[model samples]
Target: MSDLLERLRGRGWRLTSQRRVVAEVLDGDHVHLTADEVHSRAVERLPEISRATVYNTLGELVCLGEVLEVATDGRAKRYDPNAHRPHQHLVCSGCGAIRDVHPQGDPLAGLPQGERFGFVLSGAEITYRGLCPECADRG
Candidate 1:
């Protein structure tokens, strides 16, 4: 069973066949898939699964704080299942691939007191953009 399935079961979330397939499709490291991508994969597992079902399941997962919605390119929002862990993103400039990155120290520490402008800091998202080895090698 995937971590997502375990979490969902622990929370008593109803796991229909369609929902289970959707969750299964999303299980993996550095997995950031858009709704369409998830739907496509879910359909492969369960031929009758509907796109709306996948979208709804994704929305519910996001609402439950079990998944993170990432808007990396301003085109489509990708769903990330690693919501419990604190991390940033490393995006490939050429291929748009995203990887989870854990940098040392507090990210907020980099912002001086005056720079805060009086708002409380909850978290920060720092995305490092560069070409992956595959893209770099292609050049």
Candidate 2:
């Protein structure tokens, strides 16, 4: 996480206290959190941080390529700190939980060239949906 901070600092990011707290909350594991979730967590560390600050920090991170914005569904978008890696997402239909996954094969190749409709494709995402183990066990 320090590496990320240093990179941002080298790029002229101010690294304010609120931004630092937001970064701390985002670090570690394959964290997929919404802005509200981030704000909720940030409040635990810096109770005075506002939702607007967290949102702006997250947006700056996204613009800097330090984070990935994932829309697994119609709900709030999720922030993924594992932006430097290539992976897909697995969603729990029952609980709305999200997981990062690396599936085998090139998903982009499956799309026929003729169907592209002239727009150049840069990347693709696949979202697999199903009931998680705990949710399935509840049946």
Candidate 3:
């Protein structure tokens, strides 16, 4: 069983065949796949699986806080299974490839009280953009 599957099971989420396949497809590091990408992979394992099922399962996962929806560079949203972990993203500006980055310190700490406009902060998201080695090599 993958970490995602384990977590879902722990949360008492039903593990149907379609949902299992979708979860398996998302079980990996730096895995940031769009819904279509996930459906493509799920279809390989479960040919009977429909795109709608994949989409619905992804939506449920996101709502359950089991997956993170990432919209980078105005491109299609990607589903990340590293929700339980604390990390941000490092996106390759050239290819749009994403990697998980665990930077030091609290990101919200840098925000000055005056700049906050008096709203309480719960969390923050920071995306660092640069070229990956493959993209840099191509450049």
Top TM-score hit: 3
lDDT, residue 8, model 3: 93
C-alpha lDDT (0 to 100) for residue 9 of candidate 3: 91
Cα displacement (angstroms), candidate 1, residue 76, comes to 1.5
lDDT (tens digit, per residue) of candidate 1 on 46-116: 99999899999999999999999999777589999988888999999898889999999999898999999
What is the Å distance of residue 49 in model 1 from its true position? Answer: 0.4
- Stretches of candidate 3 off by over 4 Å are none
TM per candidate: 0.95, 0.87, 0.96
Worst 10 residues of 3 by lDDT: 1-10
Give per-residue CA lDDT, model 2, range 33-76, as digits (tens): 99999999999999999999999999999998988898866878
**Total clashes for model 1:** 0
lDDT string, candidate 3, 68-114, tens digits: 99998799999999998889999999988999999999999989999
TM-score for predicted model 1 compared with the true structure: 0.95
Question: Who wins the lDDT comparison?
Answer: 3
Question: Which scores better on TM-score, 1 or 3?
Answer: 3
lDDT of 3 at 38: 100
How does model 2 fare in lDDT? 0.86
